[model samples]
Target: MTSPLPFLVVQTALYNRLKNDATLSSLATGVYDFVPETALYPYIHIGEAIDTPDNSHDRYGGQTVATLHVWDQYKGFKRVLQIGSRVQALLDHQPLTITGLTHIVTRYEFGQPLTDPEPPGDIRHLVLRYRIVTEQTP
Candidate 1:
């Protein structure tokens, strides 16, 4: 099994990046790994994560699959999409800095926006997928 450190690193990287982004931080009030109790709407969440071995020629490494979700009830998909674009620009094919691991590469896998059904009106969910490659670093 691949180590989970890479996954956590990627998750933290996402959180930090989004939280500090002038656009996303201002648009979304909350950025979290796990949805917080009493969390307000129009927040960003680090959703699912999975890791796999990327060993070749005796180079041990991990490739992590990360998912990010953007939730907004702002009466339109525009806000959610704008935030999603910022996230994509930050991560897509962009190298990330992962503590305790050497970040090889991070790239966008796919992303889409869906109309949320739970809250009923003007709710949008942006689902994003990213692939992160990491090798152990002391």
Candidate 2:
């Protein structure tokens, strides 16, 4: 079976970085394996992660795909966009030290923003996906 340690490591790394960030800290932030119920706008939810085996004949590794959700109840996308930009700056192409894994690289895969009314409410959703490559350490 595949180990979840890499995913957990990536999640922890992102949470550690963003939680301390001046911008994101002001808003409602959640770094978890599942979304939580809360009454907070301009929220940052770091949820959902998947890992796929990316190994070769002489190496063991995996490519992790993770999603970051930026949500706002505000009428415009400006706030979400700004926050998203900050997130990108903090994480995109940045090197991360993940426990139990030797990090290779972390970069943005893509980001899609939209007007979402899911959960039966009006909100702006900016979803960013990232790819983190890693190999087993020791």
Per-candidate TM-scores read 0.88, 0.85
Reference-based lDDT, each prediction:
0.82, 0.80
Mind giving the per-residue lDDT tens digits that candidate 2 earns over 90-129?
8988888788888898889988889986675679989999
Find the 10 residues in a row with the least total lDDT in model 2.
Answer: 26-35
Error of model 2, residue 55, in angstroms: 1.2
Candidate 2, residue 50: the lDDT equals 87
| TM-score: model 2 vs. ground truth | 0.85
Predicted model with the maximum TM-score: 1
Off by over 4 Å in 2: 1-5, 27-35, 118-121
